[model samples]
Target: MSLRRRIAAVAAGVLAAPLVSVALPSAPAFAHGYISSPPSRQAQCAAKTVSCGAIQWEPQSVEGPKGLRSCNGGVAHFAELNDNNKGWRVSNVGRTVTFNWVFTARHRTANYEYYVGGQRVANISGNNQQPPATVSHTVTLPSSGRQTVLAIWNIGDTANAFYSCVDVNAG
Candidate 1:
């Protein structure tokens, strides 16, 4: 009611705005998933096995516009995932390689696509509920050499897809 009291109340309300939001009961956080095994570039960073940029904080959220073929899910803040100079760790694989995807919040999956040197090596149907915490598929690459494996997880219900790049020296 008093002027000084009113001014204090206004200042308190302004200061408490952020805390109020922080204190509110919000919905559970559901994170998008990424490749963990044969660790994707972001995965490597997330594991702290490789030192790098922002992707290190959110390896499981490397999502971008739907149908994006590049790592970092075509997002710039995650651009480090697409950088070869990031000193990404590489794995050795035979012509046949098994890619393991780790999902935190599983969505109905449309399909899983695998690419090597821009060539589609495998197209597996995922027309079902999200797989387990880790879903793996063995794909046979056409050639053997050092290359990047681009894995795309297309959501069955939505238009977006998760992308991950695994660098490997193929034997």
Candidate 2:
């Protein structure tokens, strides 16, 4: 073949190489759920009038390790949320208070657990098959001056986790 033709062929080969190579797989997808009934409005009331005020919570996303890409990579986990001790604050005034939460998972099912003042209040596993889900629960205030409400979520296979909270009035 002619020198010019050979050079042209080499350049063509190099350019085409990228097209032949396979692309990296995309990260998995996850959904965010919603907080169920006893709507926020119903729960919201004068901190002094109600024995317990309304509380709302949700899972939060976090940054994951370097390069270890996953739908929830760098995402916060349930353990991390609690360890950080970051959540909503509520008053436990011995009134009937309600807690609500919702979230979705990616590539797998999710599990949720609720707690108040370090005591377990409710647990729901496999809430939904897809992302954008919702779950909730309610409890009475301890009649104490103030209380804390905690909500945690575990996404499927991936280590992604999140949590959030609201403050309620304690009677």
Candidate 3:
């Protein structure tokens, strides 16, 4: 190759190397998951039962640091999920409610937890193993009336977890 052409080719490769490295790793950092059955807030957004922004396109991407209580996993764009007055539909159910989750990329799980009124009601251990594409847990409602259930999937291999909130009217 000519000297000028060889130098130009090497320069282009060097400039693009960092961009490729940075982009590839982030694709797997997103542990995609969310509660689907009973229609968690994101699920509602995906179904268009509720109007939303970017979350409507990715119902399973609500990931954040573990121990967060926010429905949007503290993601700024997903703040709509944290809005209590967003016209979210509430499911009518008996005391026993079954929460279901769907995952696009299943990670090793630490556990799955459920909260009602900011208090924990159920914690199903994942035994520090990867879960199936779908999982379910049944927990009895602690009180009657309209309630928001926060379901969290704690990933065993990472410090992040997936969060979802379901509105319900337990009779």
lDDT rank order: 3, 1, 2
Model 2 lDDT, residue 156, Cα? 57
Candidate 1 vs candidate 3: the TM-score winner is 3
Q: What digit string (tens of lDDT, one per residue) describes model 1 on residues 52-147?
A: 777777778877667677887878887777778878888988878888888888888889999887888899998767677788899888888889
How does residue 104 of candidate 3 score in lDDT? 91
RMSD of each: 6.0, 10.5, 3.8
**Per-residue accuracy of model 2 over 28-111 as CA lDDT, tens digit each:** 444444333232211222122223222122222322332332222334332332322333333443466555654444434466
Question: Better model by TM-score, 2 or 3?
Answer: 3
Candidate 1: which stretches are off by over 4 Å? 1-29
Expressed as tens digits, the lDDT of each residue in 38-99 for candidate 3 is 99999999999999999998999998999999898999999999999999999998889988
Candidate 1 colliding pairs, count:
0
Candidate lDDT values, in order: 0.84, 0.44, 0.92
What ranges in model 2 sit over 4 Å off?
A: 1-96, 104-107, 139-144
Task: Tell how far residue 141 is off in model 3, in angstroms.
Answer: 1.1
Q: Comparing 2 and 3 by lDDT, which wins?
A: 3
Whole-model alpha-carbon lDDT for candidate 3? 0.92
In model 2, the Cα lDDT at residue 112 comes to 55
Q: TM-score of the candidate numbered 1?
A: 0.81
